[model samples]
Target chain A: MSRKLLLWLPFALVFVLFAVFWLGLKNPDDRIIASNMVGKPLPEFSARAAMPDRPGVTSADFTDGKPRLLNVFASWCVPCVREVPVLLRMQQQGVEIVGVAVHDSSPALATFLAQNGNPYDRIGLDEGGRAQIEFGSSGVPETFVVDGKGRIVHQHIGVVTEQDVPQLLGMLGKAQ
Target chain B: MRRLAALALLIAAPLPAQAQDYAEVALPDPAQEAQASRLMDTIRCVVCQGQPISGSNADLAGDMRRIVRERIAAGDTPDEVRAWLISKYGDWVSFKPQVKPATLPLWLIPLVALVLGIWLVSRRLRRHH
Candidate 1:
């Protein structure tokens, strides 16, 4: 082989390999299309609630009585802020909305509620995110529909819209 | 070939030690820890720009970790924190950009270019043959 060709061969091989690897990697932003977890029992995990002028409350305190919507949110998350109005609307329609403040502070949460208007019946403070992982949440603005039996019926990732309400209600069997 | 072999060895040697260190950390609250880990996976490291803080070892990632802990501690709420970050850094701070008119091209350009490349190559091959 020509000397030029011999020197160029290794570079060409490396380039091709790099290109293949780069192309093969999946897109980072691809939607996480979850398998059916509907009709199945929810994961057993306890979460604390953000109490009024107090430390906070726990999942043990609010898991009983009625089926509820557990919304995992944070002040820093944009999508979560976008979904707040939708959640407020749900709360207006008598949807039992419980908040899980993941990795946030009490005063900041108090301020957030003061500014945004609190829609949650009970808010769980998962400051360290210990409770969040058990629920299999990868990020904030995750909503879970928990049945009266304390089983999670549905999980919504990203900003929830008004259009999602009927579907959420349908899962809860509250939709007309 | 020799250089490549040496590079591979260098890369492989550190990974086991790092993995061992990760495993050795005693996670008192596994659930909360997992949640923090998951959140890190979605949030882009400010300094790295392209990679998530979960995958990044940059000093900025550590700052982001502290920020995450603070937000969770302060009860700012996850959604609010994401909004704050986006407001501060723009949508690029998010590992996943929302699909919109502006971002559609980012998704479609690759496929369009692939098709064009194939067509051009086939045309050239036909002419050569």
Candidate 2:
């Protein structure tokens, strides 16, 4: 009876471990832990102008007494294209957006904006993608809410959906 | 045998280069390059969760490798680079998690489990004896 109980215990332990692993895998949201950039001043960066008609953006622009969204995007990132409608909605609602084009080639960006409608007021060309990394972004489609004082108030990882608009607006309010 | 040769050739070509991003650092310092390589192994590829930047081919991992090399070339010590990354991405980016209030339980729980496991086995052995 004791030997039987010991044998059962190993199986029970294995079953419990497998059950825990399966439970952990059920969560599909893959965003990493909250960004440490929140509440910190924006990292300094200067890039070539990606938008032909607009001045190139820089860290200093965030201090212009206007709360704005700084979006990191690229022609290669699919999720940035998906978030276009949400960005358009924000633009229509009077939100000023600064776009940073990672690994930018001006012609590709011009075509991308012409096809998707330009939502950016100031666009910077981060040709080496160094500025995006300085922003602590893992990939494109990452947005930062910057206050009038040049501090990063919030960070949104992955694609921003319609549902995320309300929280983004709320953060904008706080940025005010 | 031809299929086997093709398979081996496929493995021999381009695959290893993909595993190690060989974007030659223009800087003439081998020591900095070695330090950057070591530092890359200690940072997580944020988008790919469990894989370290050293072994991942994911785009973010490539970006991370570039950043590691650039910083090391720019004269930041490995500790400074680690601090900067941790400051931006939070503690989760480090392969070696720093000892902090939040991580104390994570370190202790494994030891606690091991002790409990040993205790259980010893109890079972005593019962058999």
Candidate 3:
């Protein structure tokens, strides 16, 4: 608390704040989709089945002891249409994908799946999109890599292009 | 001619009517509706960088508005509704962050700056007096 120390304190604080800003700008990815729910247990959710024959998806589905992708999408989402093939490719590699169709009509969703080929292991319909909010999704086509123990390891916001597949796989590989 | 050009520009730039999805025209109880609207003003649109859900016409913001109204109409207080959103979307969703251990600095820095400014001003006033 000396006068000399006090004189230097403001500059030191400004320097620290500048460094923090610089570091944040250095890695833009972390700030792109900030979520407090990352690295935490996936919240519980249940929604009606999008398909008639398949059972609806629930939080209990993830407890089956396998790592999987919980994807929030809608038939109305153009980006969701674009990502269909990538999801299918992931499925080909034995990735388990659970789908939650948000703010969509069941008939329209069925038609979308029929046209694009369904890649989901199980599908759920989020009528009000309340379930999507629980997943901390900013918008449609957000994906969470849930580990075997049901912890959300990583989330990919926005369109999941082909390039993101490997990075997502790497996250799943790193998760216990 | 200038007014006509301005009108043309206005008509040419189609409004974002489609983006808002009409937001369901159903009106709820007047008191509850006002409460929900106020709450929406306080809640930030998670998808939007810094805008409140009430101001955003984004689809997700529309969904947030619906949920806010639904919860409030179902007898939840505004604080309870906000707490529920925070549970799902975290403190970032609320423009007014609750006073908690982690947010103490965010809540106090402005106050500290204000107090310092006032003290400096008062010291200058005393010298002048």
The RMSD of every model to the true structure, in order and in angstroms, is 14.7, 7.0, 8.3
Instruction: Please provide, for model 3 over A119-163, each residue's C-alpha lDDT reduced to its tens digit, 9 standing for 90 to 100.
Output: 898889997676888787887888999988888888888878999
Candidate 2, B117: how far from true, in Å? 7.8
Better of 1 and 3 by DockQ: 3
Q: Rank the candidates by TM-score, best first.
A: 2, 3, 1
In model 3, which residue pairs have backbone atoms overlapping below 3 Å? none
TM-score of each: 0.50, 0.76, 0.73
Worst 10 residues of 2 chain B by lDDT: B19-28
Candidate 2 vs 3: which has more TM-score: 2
Tell me the tens digit of each residue's lDDT in model 1 across A1-176. Answer: 69779657757977998988787675444445231334455545555546664434455543465778878888766667778888898889888787888768777887887777788877767755555544655567888887877666778877889889899988767411
iRMS of each prediction in angstroms?
A: 12.2, 2.3, 3.5
Between candidates 2 and 3, which one is better according to lDDT?
2
**What is the CA-based DockQ of model 1?**
0.03
- After superposition, the stretches of candidate 2 with alpha carbons farther than 4 Å from their true spots are A1-33, B1-28, B109-129
Off by over 4 Å in 1: A1-22, A26-40, A53-57, A61-65, A174-176, B1-129
